[model samples]
Target: MGLAIGWTDAGIARLLLPGDTPADMRQRLGQAGGSEKHDGQPELAARIAAYSEGARDSFRDITLDLDGVPEMNRRIYRHIRELEWGETTTYGAIARWLGDVAMSRAVGAAMGANPIPLIVPCHRVLAADGRTGGFSSPRGVRAKMEMLALEKAASPNGQFSFGF
Candidate 1:
């Protein structure tokens, strides 16, 4: 597993999760037009590393640079960022929060397009049937499950329930 993060003056701009080779991470970052420099966010990097090791950090206070993202997607990401550790929600629920349950697919699309996965907490969003749904990380749904498991393990009671 390899992790890479890209930061901008505004905040973190992109994150490549564990599971890719270093070369793959570099190429992906380059393709996303993010600089390969890892010098900007030492504290954040440390937090992320701790998170990968199953430490609890809601990360809600972290700022993100969603400059090119559409307004709807931004809204979706904001809502997702409010989800606490070990909490999970359905795409349909988020769609309804957006004022239309029919927008479930749209919510899924927004999750897929999210550049900052862990901070945005896209893995917390599930399918209406309680399925893991899609995760765009290199490890795909497996990575999503791993993150959820980590959060669950970090919970105070070592337990969590699905919502909506």
Candidate 2:
């Protein structure tokens, strides 16, 4: 698996997960107005690598460049970023926190549109019924589940179980 990240002067702007070939990743990065050779933030890259290797590294301190993100999505991303390793939340729970259960779909949409996935931790959001919801990664739900498993994430009831 290959991973690529893009950053702006503000902070990290994008993260491309595995599933694309190295060449494809480079092409995508180029299309996104970035060069594959830009390693502007090596420390952040190291942290991401450590986390991917099963370390409990937290990205809470890392800054993000969300210049064009909608206000609502920014709010949701902030909330999701607070979730620690091994913790999980439901889309409905996030919606309720936003003061409306009806916004569950909106929360899901925001998660889907998230530019930074692992760093923002959108995979931590599950379905209201406790099932793994949609993940925008190319690997989809499988990738989301893998991330949960990596964190040994607990269910909403506080019991650890990846079976969900």
Candidate 3:
């Protein structure tokens, strides 16, 4: 299946198709590339900032721009993308969810491989030590830390802990 993508509205936390058009989704993500255009392209910027704000109503309704993803990473990332805005699961947790053992590191690698960090929310994952985990964005750990804080305040899964 093609990559199914959507967005969360930080202003009102919920996930939805931007235009309710599946064809549009296929067209956008069908041959997409890096995160460069995503960083500030109208709808793209809104989605990224919504998640970054850690607001509870993130996905209440928004548009998704999924396009190009490799099969391997897609297998892992599709599940990762479903992670709620404020909730987090560990690398180890994601591996087990994939029905695999000893693949926690591989899960971490998968998270890092996400082209759409804020959208896929790789920042929601963490090291076992409860520290903000790595993110592929240029902001590095700084971005991770801020994201954790944002979610901590509005998480429905309030189970995550970050050492800051």
Rate residue 62 of model 3 by lDDT. Answer: 38
Residue 116, candidate 2: Cα error in Å is 0.3
Write down the worst ten-residue block by lDDT for model 3.
8-17
Q: Tens-digit lDDT track for model 1 on 1-164?
A: 36889878898889989888898999999988897885677888889999988888889999899899899999999998998888888888998899998999999899999999999999988875566778999989888878988877332233333422
- Output the lDDT of residue 10, model 2: 91
Candidates arranged by lDDT, highest first: 2, 1, 3
**Candidate number that wins on TM-score, 2 or 3:** 2
> How many backbone clashes are present in model 2?
0
Q: How many clashes does the backbone of model 1 have?
A: 0
Give the TM-scores of the predictions, in the order they appear: 0.90, 0.90, 0.60
lDDT of 3: 0.55
Per-residue CA lDDT of model 3 for 63-141, tens digit only, reads 4444444665667766766777567777777788878858888888877767565556677777665655566654476
Question: Which portions of model 3 show Cα errors greater than 4 Å?
Answer: 1-41, 50-54, 57-68, 153-164
Better candidate number, 1 or 3, judged by TM-score = 1
